[model samples]
Target: MEDINTPSTTGLMDRPAGPDYRLGAIPLAPERFSTWKERLAQWRALRDAPLYLEDGRARAARGAERHAKRRLSVHHATQYGHVFSNKRIPRDVQAAAMGRFEADLIALTPRRVLVLEVKNWSGQLKVAGDRWVQVQRSGAEVTHPNLLAHNREKLRALHRYLAHAGVNIPAERFHQAVIFVNPRLEIDPAIADHPAVLCMDDVGDVLGSGTSLGRHMAARLVQLLTDAETNATLAENLLKVIPPTEVAAATAAIKGLRTWDRLTLRGGRELQGDIIWLRLTGNQAPAAALKPGGAASLEWRRGVIGGIQWVLRNRGAGNLRGDIFWDQHLVPGRRVPLDADDCVYFHEPGEPKPSIIALSHVERLQIG
Candidate 1:
């Protein structure tokens, strides 16, 4: 692992120094176009007499997200991992999915993948059967869907996406929580005692070395993933599922384009060069498939004298499988691999020979 002494990483943790406590936050891209003119709005709209710039609940939600992230960054947690903020499902993946799910934040560690949904609502909150009701200061009441159930669906969708990309981790290894970020919020005792519902101050207890009502919640978290994978392996696999543009944006945020690539090795060595590609091997196939005209005709069946029933049948088909050689590259060239060596080849600007490092030793590769 690379040293955590660098300025870029030191400020991320608020607790006293601990060995191997490395953490990083990936930066998201800013908005591209600001004004309607820049976006080339319709002539009729642009010609309107007055322009409207309003902020409602959206502004409050954004503020709460900022507050939650800030508190999380400084929390005295012993776990080391990367936190992805405002993670959006890629457009291509969303097209085939039923709903547009967005995670407020995703905390990924070797042992646990935690999905956090932050809510900034401030009021007297109560659980009414399957829904939640909020009593505002102005004597107004608002009803909201069950956030706990909604976040659970998001977690399941995330698992589906990862499994589709060949990174199959046990569902037990994933966890979800709904964090109320507003300090002014008041929650009913019945619902606040829930395991998945938490307030801002409870974050450290659930995530790391802290306790909730005499319970070692952090230790309990470890029990959820008895047989966990290595940090590097999970990171590499997760990178495959994440879009390349987002990866590039994260690289730019961590360290500017000072080099073509930054290779962080598990042995604490950092190298600068052009990372051509990564050599990964796996097999992929659809779970099942159907052949053309595989449906059987419907038939009517009669029970002794009770009723008539229609039966529909289908002919099962075989699965189509293929080997996957995913070698993602920084600079484009031949996409296919010529050999089976699982190593990363790095080349300096004017170096005659490329440095070959075994894939297992590399911790992370950041593209410039």
Candidate 2:
């Protein structure tokens, strides 16, 4: 297990404090999907096969490459789980040929958008101008792809993709990092000194350092990535059946509906909707005639523009009659007109007091 200790920084944005406020998790091991395992097996089988077997060698190389990527992906999940796990933006996205470049991981923080390239090579590595060389354990030397050059192309393609999707992230805000996942690997002093190149251990310290503004920027970046990922997932689920214009309009409408004051209760429960019901735990009566049962219901209905009809109902035994005071105020028999942001409370007469159980709101209405 890799431990990442983030240094406390000043200027972080004010946010909710608690365990639930965290964005991601760190897993001890890389996730091994069936596809990755299959590729690994294929690579191992053909790696030392006949030299004349060109197709086998090529397949083996691809397998090795994918296996390395998988290992790095796992390492990253463990090392940066707190910052990246369960984030809105999907990591390790494989682009189609049309995208021109595939990314190992795309991380969006408040300050910048990071495109990471994971290289899991062992032994000694050196870079001379545009050339990258790797020396194996058996004293064998080989030239590998120029990761920086390759990532540059990927960055350009990503920009184009974002532009086409109507995202307006500036190029200056886009950054890149090449992570060498192998712990046993050694790098030439010149290449290791480069800012963009990092070993697995250095990732946490670098990202965790800096001022409060940097931390806030990271948080915002995470949000943007998450939103982008959500939109992409929605688009995929819709199968592109809906036109982009209509989809954008519908999305905007949904966002508008969510802009209401949320009701937070004891035990960390929250309710935000047009209709909320509170079930009391004990017997409470507003009046002698009205024997209150253990439940109170609140309803909000839209009337004229921003006007709200706030209705409160008390469930009790026998024929109910007369009005009762709700929160030291006269309760209307029908509905009380109030502002959208008005707060309401329910009181019960016994131990283990009243609590909000359910909330229901109209998100959308479909018309044929």
TM-score to true structure, per model:
0.43, 0.34
TM-score: which candidate is best?
Answer: 1
| lDDT tens per residue, model 2, 230-254 | 5444433432222233234333322
* Total backbone collisions, model 2: 10
Q: Write model 1 residue lDDT over 1-368, tens digit each, in one string.
A: 56666554556754433222111221122123223332222222212213222246756786788887777666544133456665543324446544345678765543455678999887799989999999987779999888888888777766666655555555766788999978788998877888988888788655644223222343333334433343224333532222222223332332211224555544445555555543333222121221211111111111211111111111111111222112223314322221111345566546876665543334344543
Q: Supply the global lDDT for candidate 1.
A: 0.49
- Would you list the C-alpha lDDT of every candidate in the order shown? 0.49, 0.40
* Local lDDT at 267 for model 1: 40
User: Which residue pairs collide, candidate 1?
Assistant: 1-266
Candidate 1's C-alpha runs over 4 A off are 1-51, 74-79, 89-97, 209-368
